[model samples]
Structure formats: structure tokens, C-alpha cells
Target: MADPQSSQLPEDELTVPRAPLNKMIKELLPNVRVANDARELILNCCTEFIQLVSSEANDICNKQAKKTISPEHALQALDSLGFGDYLQECKSVLEECKTVAAKKRKASTRLENLGIPEEELLRQQQELFEKARQEQAAIEQQEWLQLQAAQAAQAQQQGLHLQPGMQPTAATGGHFQPYQVAEGIPQHGAVPSLNQPSSGAGQLPTESASNQQIPPS
Candidate 1:
């Protein structure tokens, strides 16, 4: 037999592969086929997406003081990201993935509940997982389209006259515009501290002209 260590993949190669990425894109856009360049772009996009999602998930894991990344952390990351409009779709996909994983776990661990044979159970579980993946791809495609439309609409409404080097933000409503404060200027509507004495403090109000005048006047 071949050496088990030789057959094992490196930890760095654990990321999603190209074939599955292409399949996912197809599921998202069934009618719109991607050419070679488009396929490359899709790969790049998927890489970026994975990087962002994983980073966000890592943040969630850190918050919980856990070292392992879990489905709950991933779901939280998806929710926390600026995908508010596509939250429902993302949530559905996450739930479906969880369900498929649960089914596989149950099939493997709970033999008593398996009315069917082991091989048949495994096959069925595999099919369920494939279906869940397809559904998720479709959901992601819809979300992308919605985002593009929103961004376009926002640009049109804003008239795209932004200063040089300043790009229009996505209309996801989570975008923040940076404000620069002049060196000595105070912020608008800032409340002064009550504990600090004002420049005009300790001075009494001046009497009115009529009260200050002599009685003969």
C-alpha cells in the first residue's frame, strides 16, 4: 500500500477548488455562461469572497474565545457583513447546509434510525448535500444581481460627480463617508462641558439704560 502521509494534502491546499467554483457559478447563473476570462474573474471573486467571509468568521471565533471555526461563526459573519438585503437568502442557504451536515452526522452515528442500508443512506446524504450547494449558489447569484442594481441606482441618483480618487459606495446603507475636521474648528452642535468655566463667566449682567439713568432724566 502507498504511504498515508504521501497521499495526504497540505493544509494550505484546503481551500475550495476551481471545478466546484465553476459549478457554483453555473448554478447561480444558469443561462448566462461564463467564457475563459469570465471564469478567471469568477475564480478571483470567489477567492476574495472566501477570504472576507473567513476573516469575519475568525473575528466571531475570537469573540467567543474559541480556536475552531464553526457553522455558527460563519453564519454570524454572513449576517454581520454588509449583505443586509440578501440576509434572507444567505440565511436559507446556511440553514440548508446545516441540515445536510446534520443528516450526514445522524446517518453515520445513528445506525438504529437508518431504515435503509449504509450505502443507500450515504448516497442519499450526498445527493442532499449537492442540492443544498446548488441552492446556495443560486441564492448568491441573486444577491449579487440585487447588489449591482442597487449600486447602479445609487450612482444614478447621486449623479456620480464625486471628487477624484473617491469612488461611490455601495448602496447597502452600511457605507460611511469620511469627514475631515479643520484644525481649530469644533464639531457642529457639540455640547460644552458644564464643569469647565466659560470665558464670560464670573461677570454680572449689565443694568438696562432706563434703570441706570438718574431720576431727573
Candidate 2:
């Protein structure tokens, strides 16, 4: 028989956590309360049991000229170590693990399982990318057109509010220029020149006006 103390790892080097050990102890004894020392001893025993099983599994693997100890070797080690009563439960757990692993493998290869060739899948992906790019470009173009329309509307609104005689000019640094009056056109509110004759000022008195004046005398 191996020394129990020799198989025990140091507290600092313990792989099994105390919290899970405590929970398991509570679950197994439900209403019964366990002491701290009893919990520590159970934790150490669990770790030692794992080390013993692993060593036996490794020996069984080496006897078969294998470099790695597989699940089968572990089951065989349990039986050889007089723990044959756990064999059925361990097998059931092993089967559950295998089922989960199979599902993961299947999920990882779903695309390949679809039966589509790699080249076809790549071509379809490229087509989808091209369609997305075209849609984005069209959206950008529509936004640009809407922006141009808004600017044009703003310019027209501003033009309607301008003074009648003012016109926009590029030469005046984006300012308005007053409309220039043409020569010979009379300006509003200007005084007439005294030296310039009016339309009837140069004409003599009419004949009828001269005859009427002699009669009155």
C-alpha cells in the first residue's frame, strides 16, 4: 500500500478547488453540516485519487506501446484498481462527451456540409459584395442631389429678398452692385436745367390771341 501522505500535494499546489469540494459535500449530505478539517481531507483525497488513476492509466498506455493515455486506458485503470463498480457510469459520461464533441465538429463544418463547391461559394460572396457597393454608391448619389437642390432653393429665396436696383456680381467679391442708369434717361427727383428750352417756350403767340387784344382796346 502506498503512503497516503506521499500522494498528497501541497496546499499551494492543489489543483482541486475548495469551493466546489464544499458544494459537493453539502449536496451529498444535504442536512448534515461538515467541519473545515473534514472538507480539507476530502479535497486532498479527491486529488490523490485523480493522481492514482492517471498513473495507472499512463502505465496501461505504455504497456500497449502508446504515447498517450486515452479514455479506454482510464476505464481499464479503474477496473484494475478495484473500482469496477464505476465503470458503467464512467462509460455513460464518456459517451455524452463524445456526442458533444461530434456536434461541435459538425457545427464547424456546416458550410462544407452544404455540398456547395468552394469556387461557387467564393463567387457568390463576391457578387454580394458588388451589390452592397452599388447600393451604397446610389445612396451617396441621392444625398448629393438632395444637397444641390437645397442650395439652389436657398439661393433663389435670397434673390427674392434683394433691393430692386441691386444685382449679384462676381466681380464685387460676392456683393451686390447698384443698377447703372443709361445716358439720356431722366433720373428720379432731379432739378430741370433753366438754360434748356421747354417744349412750348420757343413758340410765338397765336394769331387769335393778337386779334382779341385790339378789340378790347
Candidate 3:
């Protein structure tokens, strides 16, 4: 029997061997027996499914500009690529996997900061993982609460800035106050007598010669 804890084979050698897959099928359907050819077909199908899932996961990593495919990417790919019909059924398991992966990453970072040797860190992995998990959860919760508070404050400021008639222009077509011209300024097409051209098209009449009364200068 293969040692379950042994390091996985390199990607190049990671073919889906038939025995384990067949064992799983049997466990699921103990009373049903597959014929030799049918068993081969099932094995092929299993290999194809794995290939599809791996390709989808790799695509997800590429989308995120990541060189390595992580568990989060895999989960997102599974959900987005229509393979997550069973997602609700396995939601708890997937959440636990995410938590574990996050804790591991946090632990590794913390140990590195403390100048712990990589090998020595393994001895206290559990303790470090628990500490990291707590810290990550607390940080995330705090940030979430801060974000909510900031949004609420912004919304309150917006409300205060708005007068009674204020509303989104998109939601309710904007209202325009009557366009009031300044006291001395004319409306759009109005011509003020002071600015009107004199009898000679290109020249202004002398101030004393004009019909209107002029104030003493």
C-alpha cells in the first residue's frame, strides 16, 4: 500500500492511478459492480475530470496574476466554472480548508519575521498556526468594522450635505432653479444700450455727443 503521508509525485508523474478511484466508486456504490471495460471507462473519465479541474484552476491563477495556484483560486475556479453544484453540500469543508491554508501562510510569515529556522518552525507548527489564525481573524474583523464605520460616516456626511429637494439626478431627473441673471447683467440674447453699436458701425460716438445723459467725470 502506498504511504498516504509520502510527498506527492512531481507534476509530470501525477497520473490518476486506477485503484484509488475504483476504491472510491465502490465505497459510494458498494452493491454495484463495474465490468472490466466499464471500469476502464470510469478511470478515463476520472482522469479527464482532474485535467479539467486543474486547467480551470490554472486559468484562475493566471487571471489573478499569480504564478502559483492556491486553494482559494481553486475554490473560486470551481465555483465560477460551473463545477460547484455540490458547493453548498461541501461549504463547511471548503471554508475549513481556506482557514487552514490562511493560517499556514500567516504562520510561515510570522516565523520568518522572528528569524526562526525553517526546520525548527515545524516543531511548533500547531502552536504557531493557532496564534496566526487568531491574529488573522481579529485583524480581518477589525478592518471590516472600520470599513463599515467609514462607509456609514461618508453616508451621513452625504445626507447632511443634501437639502430637502436633493436626489440623485439619475434616479429622479435633476431640477433646475430659474436661471437668474445678475442685477446688472443682461439675459442670454439681450442687448444693453451701453454696449450697442453707435450710428457709425466701427466707431463709438463721443461721450458728450451721445443721446443718453453722461455723468460728470
Top candidate on lDDT is 2
Alpha-carbon runs more than 4 Å astray in model 3: 1-14, 95-217
Error of 2 at 107 (Å): 2.6
Candidate 2 lDDT by residue in tens digits, 1-217? 3323465767656458878878888888999988888887888789889878988887888889887779999999999999999999999999999999999998779977898988998999999999999999999999999999999888877674576678778897766778787854555656777666445456565677678745464
Candidate 1 C-alpha error for residue 181, in Å: 99
Query: Candidate 1: where is the Cα deviation over 4 Å?
Result: 1-15, 28-31, 109-217
TM-score of each: 0.40, 0.44, 0.37
Candidate 3 matches the true fold with a TM-score of 0.37
Q: How well does candidate 3 score on lDDT at residue 156?
A: 73
Give the TM-score ranking, best first.
Answer: 2, 1, 3
Residues 1-217, candidate 3, lDDT per residue (tens digit)?
A: 2222243867434557777878888998899978889887777777667666677777878878888887677677678878788566557887887899999999888877999777776868978999999999999999999999999898776553455434445333543234545876676777779655555467756776787877899
Q: What digit string (tens of lDDT, one per residue) describes model 1 on residues 1-217?
A: 2222344677446346888988888899999968989887767777667768788888788889887888778778878997556667877988898899999988677786656787997999999999999999999999999999999988866655454334445673534344455854555666756555445568454457447857684
Computed on alpha carbons, the lDDT of every model, listed in order, comes to 0.73, 0.82, 0.73
CA lDDT, candidate 2, residue 10: 70
| Better structure of 2 and 3 per lDDT | 2
Superposed on all Cα atoms, the candidates' RMSDs to the truth, in angstroms, are 31.2, 13.7, 23.6
